[model samples]
Target: MEFDGKTFLTALGLAFILEGLPYFLLAERMPTVLRFLSERPAPELRRLGLTAILAGLAVVALVRW
Candidate 1:
């Protein structure tokens, strides 16, 4: 995807925020998710991460186009 200066900056800023969400959202449950990952591997984590990536991409796409 492409982006202008402001779009890229905004997407980058939002990405920084989103990257911190699980920590904020699952304060006490953080270990649970970590342990779950240790016991069972799944693609959901990757997909969830990709969702944010796609969100940034979409923002850039919209802003630049």
Candidate 2:
């Protein structure tokens, strides 16, 4: 498939909106949630992050297929 700048930008913008939505809607609880995450062990955080990455990749692959 050809590279499409517009599509890329649109996806990036959507991602930013999704990323910010929780903070915007849960402004009060976010700090507590963040603190909890911060206290987690490094390996636990890495495993969580890796899971998210794999899930994202699977979604993208399925969408593009």
- State each model's CA lDDT, in order: 0.82, 0.97
Tens digits of per-residue lDDT for model 1, 1-65 = 66589977997798789879999988899899788877754687787779977997898799879
Summed backbone clashes in each candidate are 0, 0
- In model 2, the number of clashes is 0
TM-score of 1: 0.51
Tell me the TM-score of each prediction against the true structure: 0.51, 0.90
Point out where model 2 deviates above 4 Å: none
Tens digits of lDDT, candidate 2, 4-29 = 99999999999999999999999999
